[model samples]
Target chain A: MACHELIEGHLQALARSLPASVVEELRDGLIESYEDQLERLGDAEAAAHAAIADFGDADTVTAAFVRASPGRGIAVRLLLAGPVVGLSWAAALIAGHWWTWPISPPLRLAVGLVLGLAVLMLIVAVRERHHYRTVRLAALAGATGVAVLDTTLLATVVMLPAGPSVLLVPALAASVARVLLVVRAVPEMISDP
Target chain B: MRAEALKGHLDGLLLAALEDGPRHGYAVKEALRDATDGKLDLPTGTVYPALHRLEQAGLISGSWVVVAGRRRRTYELTEDGRRSLKGARDNWQEFAAVVSTALRGAPWPATS
Candidate 1:
């Protein structure tokens, strides 16, 4: 079969198991893949077929498409986990009855904001430094930052002397934002040609 | 061969196929083969992945149905898919014109 025919046939086979929208996207991606491979191999059809064979069968490729679909990232996980962690820490502060730090409420809020933003910046910087070239590293950094922020906020609340219940709300809110930042960063991290 | 050259146009062809109506995977393959007079031949395996990718991009939707005592997946285009197909069709026309002109011993406009 000609390369185009083979690709069309493969695409039709894929349509069986997926929605048309997804099949279309994969079709575009596959075309790009084939074009790139063809260029590398001097536009030889035989070379393209060999490359496809090496890449594995259609089912494997379909599963890969499913796996790479946007939702399954550490950033998304952190985003989802953020509100729960925030509420948990707020509950802990309320129920645990810990002393407030020597700092006043306004100072604590300022500190939290600065720390949160700094952590957000660090996460962004680490991610940008790699330019989505190291997804695992980016995911690890994002998850770690969120985890540390969560832990620190919980610890600070436990250490602080009694303060207005209102103070915990802002801290919780800041943590939630931090989590969102991490989640949003995930797409940038995983996006690659 | 021109068919090999047209490999990049598979998405457009798929959208065109779905334009007629929804069809299952095997049927789509058979139709394309018939349309091309057997010029385009494909392994039985390549179509499924391409279909899934298209679905992911919101260009088409698909579902499974049992036909003739066997299960098969059916696919159809979405609004976005229709728009994309039109674009692909226009591009392919222009591209084919240029390539055919070049192949016929005519200088490209820029070169001429």
Candidate 2:
């Protein structure tokens, strides 16, 4: 039997926040329940409304799902890794240029500010409050920091007639890779409804 | 009753609903309603998360079962769940007695 519009919409909303396997089982249960209600009430439309009302709204249900889900493990790992990775890249950049051109205090200050904000957001993410918000902000800040630091390093490598050290080349490559990951993730994370 | 009133008691109610045998999410909801004489109404969506939480806590177990040509997830109580339910029932009884006595201003011991 086809699902009622309201029932389908509610299930879809839940699927947005819950794992697909959980949602698949939930969908079946909902359909079966709705069918029973339809038989009892002898009216499909009324049964759908009753089912939805009895079930509660999508927001309440999804909130509970998120709170119970183990899905935040990846987010936790990313946030926990953020500062360590950022600092490693910073150390490499400093080693490469701190003695020669000194990379300008203003640029250094900007990187520090972004990294600080990223760390703060990461703290919030770890605490599990406003989870997706904190994770998104931290990822965005981390990505911006990567962009700023990488651009400065690349420019230094190019304009410095001395060129960068072979040792620093690997660190710079690693920063590029991190930048790609953060950039790829930001869109997906921020676009989450 | 309201959802807020039922919130703390929901875990026990869910365990009790599954006490007889394994049941799907919707069936559990229906059992809760029927047991409460339709007084314990809540949004149906909320039960799924509660079930997941119980499963995570190791009080209940869930799996997919085919029913009426469709797949549904059914939940059953573990030994732990049964023990917890007994504890919950005892606690509710004591709590209700305290509230009822206080409300009626009745003495603990009857005097003629």
Candidate 3:
């Protein structure tokens, strides 16, 4: 069969199994690929057909299309959960110390913002690290850890006596770790196997 | 054929295909074959993913149409697609020129 006919046949088959919009998009993309190839080789239909026969099996193409469509991963789910859990813990920590009202309010607000930012960064890191299995998971863990540390620091700053801000050590450490994890994950996430 | 190699020039080819008006997938393939005199050889399956990516990026829009008792997906260039096509065409021309000159062992021009 002609290359176009072959594609049309596959597209028709795909339409039977997939959503209309998705099938349509796939069809259009396939057509665009045909046009692009036709422009490059000039009168090479037989060669095109052979190439398609060798490399353009319907199953392989469909699999690639499905993979390219961006399914959510564990990292994404963790990213979503991280913020909710982090903020809830931060809120609870602040609320648990009502006796220290005057001092607690400002500290609570500050910690909330810091925790929120950390959570947001975690979410971004997960997204940016979508491809790396280990690094993405590690970044998620680190983000959660930082959020926990921030919550603890808020409580410490509110309840402790005059002392050096020693909690800064772990807080900074966790933030750096999250950033490093995200950076490492980026290249892996973008590299298509 | 690796689609990655063609990625740089796809927008132009797609836009140029659409300049005649919207066309469905099969028709686009046929039109491109006629236009190129059959030089380029792309697999039919590969185009669909690229089309979806383009649509997602807002370079093209598509709709379903019934023709001759079959449903086919038709596509057209968006305004953004046109702009992208122009940019891609210009860039491709410059790139092709440089590559051609280099292949022919010509000195690179200091300025175009």
Candidate 4:
């Protein structure tokens, strides 16, 4: 069952754009279909041809699978929500007097890294439509990154030397909201297929 | 029939195909083709992605198994999927009836 010639070629074409699991499932199905065709036609080549025809061209088949993925939708949702959450935190920080805090260059660097990852995730999600795996990876990374950064922000607000002031409420609220959303979405972003 | 004609209904049609029992992707394609009398409009390859999408939606579930000494991934409708399929059927029936009325140059039946 693993060794298929004609159908393997088609799968190879699909593998260029699809995840391995998706390609693997297609391989199984196509081989089964080819065997079914062989049973009736009694000619290997003809059966292969018939099977391939029914599945259509590599381009169309790959496109269909790509379109079916949820990665892009999740990425776009994260992208849309990011700014709102960002603005909320900014408002809280500016109003709460961020200048008095003993923030280090290393902490600032870490924050910048997370923000960079977020931007990269958005770019990949918006620009790359051909390969779904890339988008899925970006979303997973984005969610995890946001969860880490947001959790840290919430912790700092609670344990700050300066009392957790009412002005910090919006930032804390936004971080909590994002953490909840990330908790809900991260499992979904896991590669089940 | 044209693929265009089958657009937007592929998910429901796929759900219907899996209604009877769990089926491998190839079997689903066969069932769809047979049910349509060999006139299934869309490409057979599409069944995989549609099945995957349904799985993501929690409508159907897929698992790997051996069949006749060959590996295959099979799909079965979940409880949510059964409800979805029923909803699909209801919608299709209503749409068909309404469109049929329009096509026949007759007015729709009065709503109760």
Can you list the residue pairs that collide in candidate 2? A54-B44, A55-B43, A55-B44, A56-B43, B1-B39
Candidate 1's displacement at residue B3, Å, is: 8.1
The residue ranges of model 1 lying beyond 4 angstroms of the native Cα positions read A1-193, B1-4, B108-112
Residue-level lDDT of model 1, residues A56-104, one tens digit each, is 5666655544444332244455555656666766675655464434656
Q: Candidate 3's residue-wise lDDT over A1-193, tens digit each?
A: 1356666666676665444666655554554555555777654464445435633666666554543442213245446555554455445444455355455577567766766665555555444422333344444454554545544655564566523444444443443444454455445334431
Residue ranges of candidate 2 with Cα displaced over 4 Å: A71-193, B107-112
User: Can you give the lDDT of residue A10 in candidate 2?
Assistant: 80
Error of 3 at A131 (Å): 16
Ranked candidates (TM-score, high to low): 4, 2, 3, 1
Q: Judging by TM-score against the true structure, name the best candidate.
A: 4
Which candidate has the highest lDDT of all? 4
Span of 10 residues, lowest total lDDT, candidate 2 chain A: A125-134
Runs in model 4 deviating more than 4 A are A1-4, A161-171, A187-192, B106-112
Considering lDDT, where higher is better, how would the candidates rank from best to worst?
A: 4, 2, 1, 3
Better model by lDDT: candidate 2 vs candidate 3? 2
What is the lDDT for A193 in model 4? 71
| lDDT score for residue B34 of model 3 | 79
True contacts kept of each: 0.05, 0.80, 0.37, 0.78
Compared with the true structure, what per-residue lDDT tens digits does model 4 show for residues A1-193?
A: 4445888888898889887877878887788778888889988889999889988888877666656667665667777888988888887888778778888879978988998897687668666757767777877787778888898887777677765567677777778887898788777667657
TM of each candidate vs. truth: 0.44, 0.61, 0.48, 0.85
